[model samples]
Target: MEWSKITSDKTALSLIAIVFVIFTIEGLFYASFLGEDGIINDVDYTIAEEDAQAHWDEYKAVTVNVDNLRQALDNGNLSLKLLDEDVSIIIFESDKADGYYRGYANGVAANQAEFSFGENAFSCYVDLGTHSYQIAPSWDIVDNKMIYAVYMTDYKKEEQRHEEYPIDPLTFEISNEDNLKHNISIEVFNPSSSLIFSEEYSISPGEVIVSPDISEFLGKHRYVVVLDGDYEFEESATVARSTGLGSSEKLYFNFINNSEYPMEVGIEVA
Candidate 1:
C-alpha cells in the first residue's frame, strides 16, 4: 500500500459504502413493488372500473330496437309513437320518392313508399297510387302533434284538394322576407320535416335560402324557420329576402299537374 496517501479510517469508509448500497436497494424495491405506473391504491382503481361499467350501462339503454324498423315497413306511413324519444327514418326507395318528395307537378298518382328509422330521424316515401315520393320527419317529436311531416303528392289531387299553382320565385320572396335571416334555428316535430326548406346565414341583416332553384328542392320540406333576432323589413327588401323570411303571412305554393293522369296530393308541410 502507498502508506503516504492511505486514509486513516478505512473502517468508516466501508460503513459509508454499505449505507449507500442499502439505500439503492430500498429504492429499487419501492419502485418494483408499486404499480407499473407507480400507483398502488386499491380504492382509486375500483372507482375507474365502476366508471367504465356506468358507460356500458348508458350505451345499452340507448341502443335502438330493430322491431321499430319492422313496424315502419308494416305501416304504409312508417309511423312511430311519440311516447318519449326522438327517432330517425330512412326511405328504401330514394329515387322514386325524390320526384314527389320535391312536390313535382307531374299528374300521376304514386304508391305508398317504405321507410326505416334510426337513432334520431325518420324518413319515408309516399305512394299516391302511381308514384313514390320521399318524406323525412323532423328530428324532434312533440307529444300529440304531427308537425314536421313530409308529404309527397300534388296539392290539387289530395283529400284536401285545393287549387294548385306554380311556386313563383318573386311571390315567395315577398311572403317570407320578414323571418329569413343569416343564422336560423329549426325544430322539427314530424316525419315529414324533411320536406321543409329553410336556411339561415349571418351574411347580412336578413335570412336567405342557400339554394332557391325549384329543381334543387322539389319535395315537401318539414322544418321550422327561426330567425336569430327580431327584424323589421321594408317593401323593397321583400323581393330580395330568402324563402323562409318576410312578413308574417301564410304563403301557399302550388304544384301544376301536367302528367298523363289525375294527380294525388300528399301532405308534408303541415
Candidate 2:
C-alpha cells in the first residue's frame, strides 16, 4: 500500500488522521450551533444595536404652540416649518376660546405645521396682526433637553408703547444669578429699518455693562435686546443724557425679548 505521509509510524499516522477527523467534527458542530456566520455576525449585530440606541438618544421632540392663531384670521397668518421631511403645521382658528376663535392657521398662515419634530432646529413664523414685519422664532438643542415654547399674538396689542425720549449715551446693564451662563445681544435699528449698531456679550454669574453713543442716529431708532440664559434675569438700563427730544436724539423702539429665556423688562424714560 502507498502509505500516507507520516513522520515514521503507521500507527502515528492513524492517530493523526483520527485527531484531524475529531477537530473537523468539532468545528462543524460549533459552526452549525450558531449558524454559518457565528461569532463574527453576533459581534456585528451587537455593534448595530449600540449604534441604533445612540441614534435614538440624540433624537429630540420639539413642539411649537401658537397661542393666538385666531388673531391672525383677519389680516395675517402663522406657520411652522421643520427641516426634516415629515412635519409641518399651518395655523388657523379651528376652535373657539373664551370669546375668540383659535386653532391651527392652516392655509392662511402656512401649509402643514405640526407639534412634533424629531430634530433640533425648526422655524415658527407668525404673520399676524396689522404690523408690517415678520415674527419668526428659532429652536435649538440645549443640554440634551429639546423643548421649545412659543407664544404668538397680535403685534399691535402685545408691543409695549414707549414714549419718545432723548439721551446722549445709551447705557445697558444685565444681571442674572450664579447658575446662569449665556449670551445677551443688543441691536440698534434706525427708522429706515437699517441695523446701525449690534453687539453681543458673554454673561457669566454677575452683572455686565454696555454703553454706546448713538449720537449720529437722531430720531425713531429701535433697540432690540436678546438674552439666552437659564435663570431669572433682570435688565437695567438708562440713557445718560438731558431729558428732551430734539431733531437729533430721539430713540424709539419696542423692546422685544425674542431670546430663549423668559425675560422681564422694566423701562424708565430719563
Task: Name the candidate that leads on TM-score.
Answer: 2
Q: Global lDDT of each model?
A: 0.26, 0.32
Clashes of 1: 58
Measured by TM-score, how close is model 2 to the native structure?
A: 0.28
What is candidate 1's TM-score against the reference? Answer: 0.26
Question: Please, what are the lDDT tens digits per residue for candidate 2 over residues 70-125?
Answer: 34332334333322212223434432322222334334443323221122322233
Error of 2 at 54 (Å): 62
List residue ranges in candidate 2 displaced over 4 A.
1-167, 229-261
Cα displacement (angstroms), candidate 1, residue 86, comes to 28
